[model samples]
Target: MISSNTAQPMKDIYLPEPADVLKASPMTALEMFFEFRLASGRELGHMPGQFVEVSIPGIGEAPISISSSPTQKGSFQMVVRKVGNVSGAMHALSAGRQVGIRGPFGTHFPVDGEMKGKDILFICGGIGLVPVRSAINYVLDHRDDYGHVTILFGTKTPADRLFTDEMQRWASAKDVTFMETVDRGDDAWKGNVGVITTLIPKVRLDPARTVAVVCGPPIMYKFVILELDKVGLKADRMYVSLERHMKCGVGKCGHCQVNGLYACQDGAVFKYSDIASVREAI
Candidate 1:
């Protein structure tokens, strides 16, 4: 028999770890904000733009993007929309409830890597804001590490806004430029009303130093890329998080394959220039 000290530990990649819900609250009619802490008391080491597989015993498991920044200590967060069985079950969970978490998988935004010293322009539409928020907060926490910060958010309606309180705080921050719009407005809405691409032309930045991050509904990508190109932002300088049916957090499952690349293993976040040649990527 091998000595216990010398034997390598075998870890099961498919087994889920237990995590306790620290807080659960509604962000919108269909979306719920969940904060969880690993039962083992360790931080969920993850980077911005990565996703985790959240599972509820008998229901199912779904890949949800990690919404909180790594700078946030103790616990991690996810904004879950009640779109299916697993997410519906997740909505019923509250603080103290325990669930299974598989991974913080996929490639992440280069926040501390290539992004250092460069200006960040965040363009998010609808639920797309969830993943990008991680990078946004990371930049804010280490504000001095980067150049300027610009955030543009657009949703279907004013009532559909997520993180209203945080949006106000971001807008009020000294060095950050925050702008929001809605496709349609209500009687109380006073901000810009149009698709998110319209806001791109209004902001001024040096294309040489600016890195644009875009995430939103599937239809939003092509139009947003066009708008960014018109504003002098090169495809190489832009990054996007593509939405796919990622069944397994690891690449073994072929569910999230786009062309020859696996969204789960290769990327959920990819440089526009790199994936531009892949027909299904955009």
Candidate 2:
């Protein structure tokens, strides 16, 4: 028999692209958006807090943060807030509607082996919780891999809260400390009635051994970082996920550029130290 390598040059086999609309389903009021699930139980092969770009033929694409954890296989979730044209179009979509996806992109919040066994303070504001929720769930799923897990989450109001069902579960989770705040309140709203910063002072944390993962509106980051510093958390120990109008999702499009960093490619997640000088990062 002829040796395979010497007998014929390796040939590249190209496959047709798969359909864009992932496993689309309506869950509660929010569309339960899924991108890549196979009936065979194949995993998304993603890291927590990364994102995927979803596209429609005529409407173009948008970079959406993956809200599900890597621990969840077979599918990934993206919580679209229905704020823009693409998202608006997505809102009208029904189950099995085809949408294109390209990603699992951006640098994930550092969960290096070193981060294991350290205390974690997770902070989220508004729908900003959507992205950070991935990391929080990943850590929570592997509870023994770390020490204390404290989550400080806030929303514009109680009605605007995302992941309500999951939040209830997390609030009562063993060994996890969960707190929430609302900027404005309705008659039905109880719990903390102030900015998320108000809740920060109540959860005591050891700054030396703690790492903070924060995501929120641009305004919230500036104020929250100050609070974290006041409590003695180091800049390097704090990470933030930035929001910018990203187009290409691969850094080629200049839409998501903040100073010299591309929020699409270089980040959507950045450590405080990495972009300290980037005035526009906030």
Candidate 3:
């Protein structure tokens, strides 16, 4: 039997390729974020749902999801939660701070020819919306290139919501549908109050043709997937992003291993089918 915890050593890990910090700012006290513009002015050439590794000297690096869409040129943004050593140092940084970066890694959502003319459903939870934001924005920017779009987002509470300004605009867009929920409601919160799964039932979707992308804390995956399946969306039609402690941005690092597959290289973005057999992927 395969050892579920067998992992590679860090000495074998590969370093991330470098990029420049073009901009940085505070989204919240716990969140210090930045946008990196590749030196070549070339697109990261990534599909939605990929990530990059950002580093501050001496503090090390961590895998952060690319929160900006591939369709948006010039730069890509990553929002880091100030929770640990590396992230705390990142939060103390300022604009034009030089940092190490590598990637544009992981499999991406199938947004090209296959998704065209089909409805798309995005169900994001808390900070999970950060990664999903890329795809949502891409679809929105190229609105005419696809069919109906619905975004159902939920967070812990009103103050914890990310990208409020952009979310408001998305909700009001002529061609998009948006609704939000807070697990615990505050007096100022007028939106739905409950688990995000509760909002799934109200969504109008042709499950056979609709593509659903859901991301959140690992514990939230199972319940959300069950809700999507209840709507008749096939497991293969659903995609989810999995998070792991990653030391290397490339596959060489064993930190992100899920059995034989490396979350850094093989996933971070995966179809339900791709990881369905991988025991720890949920």
**Candidate 2, superposed: residue stretches over 4 Å from native:** 1-42
- The digit string of per-residue lDDT tens for model 2 on 200-267 reads 88988999889999999899998998999899999999989998888877778689989888998888
Cα-based lDDT for every prediction: 0.94, 0.80, 0.83
Off by over 4 Å in 1: 1-6
Top TM-score hit: 1
In the range 1-282, model 3's lDDT, one tens digit per residue, is 977876875552345545678777888767756888776567777778888777777888777899998878888888889888888888777766677766777877777755677788988988899989998998888888878899999988788888989998999998788989999998888889999999999998998778888889898899999898898988888888889987776777588898888887788878887787889899
TM-score of 2: 0.88
Clashing pairs in 3: none
TM-score of each: 0.97, 0.88, 0.90
lDDT of 1 by residue, 1-282 (tens): 856797677988888999999999999998999999999998899999999999899998999999999999999999999999999999999999999999999999899887889999999999999999999999999999999999999999987899999999999987899999999999999999999998999899889999999999999999999988998989898999998999987999899999999999889999999999999999
Window of ten residues with lowest summed lDDT in model 2: 11-20
| Candidate with more favorable, higher TM-score: 2 or 3 | 3
Name the candidate that leads on lDDT.
1
